[model samples]
Target: MKNAIVTGGGGGLGKSICTELSKNGYAVAVLDLKIKDAQRTSEGLENASAYAVDVRDHSSVIEFYKNYGKAPELIVNNAGIARFNKLLDQKIKDFEDVIQTNLIGSFIFASEGVRLMIKEAKKGSIINITSIHSVSPGIGVGAYSPAKAGLASLTKLMALEWGEFGIRVNAIAPGFIDSGMSKPFFENPKIRELRGKAVPLQRLGTSEDIAKTVLYLSSDAASYVNANEIIVDGGVIHSVLMHLPRE
Candidate 1:
């Protein structure tokens, strides 16, 4: 049977990705920092196991792979944190925290996951959940943009270098999703309505939207798709001017 590993699998969007993979017959390792949340996510799912893992900690990840017993067919680097503060005003520790979890954490997992794939003779998928902020900078999101941007670049480098091992590396940049870390930002109805309408699709994205994309990149259909970062932001990146006061 196939297996998959998902970081931050306990969160709202992570749960959706785990559910989709589980539904598709993959025995999923739902790794989260919170063990209870991981267990909650793994419960009622077929062949799923919950594990507490800090994606930023190399030792923690090593222990997980050792205990779990093998490499997975796919790995999703979805563990991240957002520290919203102007670059100049933010504390250095807060900035470092975001970079450590969002960027370095991904590096640790992606590299180790690839090593396992090569060792086990498995061709797999590595999906990094980057943000639109990676390309278009957002206000008050300290270090997030740089971290994601770095992740996107790292995706290309992985594809370039890991292709020899038959592994595919890609990134998915989700737009204004109404779930997970972005959920709280939408609690104010005005902000929600304003952001929703700004999308060319006239709505915000859902966890399912990102989950389906994850499945696609993991499947054989995307066998030839690699080294690419697909943007699933409902045309928001291209609609910057459309939302302006225009005739």
Candidate 2:
């Protein structure tokens, strides 16, 4: 069975990804900062295990592999944090924290996953979960946009450099998904309705929506696809012009 590691695989979209991957026949390792949360996510999934890992900490991530005993062929760099504040009001430390976890953290895990794959001589896939903000920055999202933008660029670079080894690197840019950190915000009926109406699909995206995309990218169906960013925003990002006055 193919082994896959999903960082932040404890709840929300990460948990959904774990469920989808497990259904697709991959032995999954659910890595999260909170072991209990990871365990909760892995429960009832055959061949799925949980490990506590802080993606921003190099030593912590390294320790996971040291204890895991087997290399993973597929990695989903989905761990991230976000802070909402204006650029001017956002603290330098807060901004850096977001960048470290969202951008640098993905880099650390992806690099380690690649090393393991190369050692095992396994053709692997690395999927990074980026946000639609990477292309369309929102107000008061200080560091998130830049971090995701950097991650997207890094995905391309890795794909370009590692394609020779048959390592595929790509990203999914999800817009307004109702999961993880954004769940609380969407819980507000007013905000929820507004967000739903804003999308061209006239509906909010569910965690399963993103999970299905991940499964596709990880499967042989996408064997020839690499160095690409799939936008799963229901055409919301492209609907800005439609918001203007129309005859």
Q: What is the C-alpha RMSD of each candidate to the true structure, in Å?
A: 0.9, 0.9
* lDDT, each prediction: 0.93, 0.92
lDDT of 1 by residue, 137-227 (tens): 9989989999999999999999999998889999999999999999998999999999999999999999999999999999999999999
**lDDT score, residue 62, model 1?**
86
Off by over 4 Å in 1: none
Give the TM-scores of the predictions, in the order they appear: 0.98, 0.98
lDDT of 2 by residue, 95-182 (tens): 9999999999999988977888888866899999999999888899999999999999999999999898889999999999898889
lDDT: worst 10-residue window of model 1? 238-247
What is the Cα-based lDDT of residue 66 in candidate 2?
A: 84
Clashing pairs in 1: none
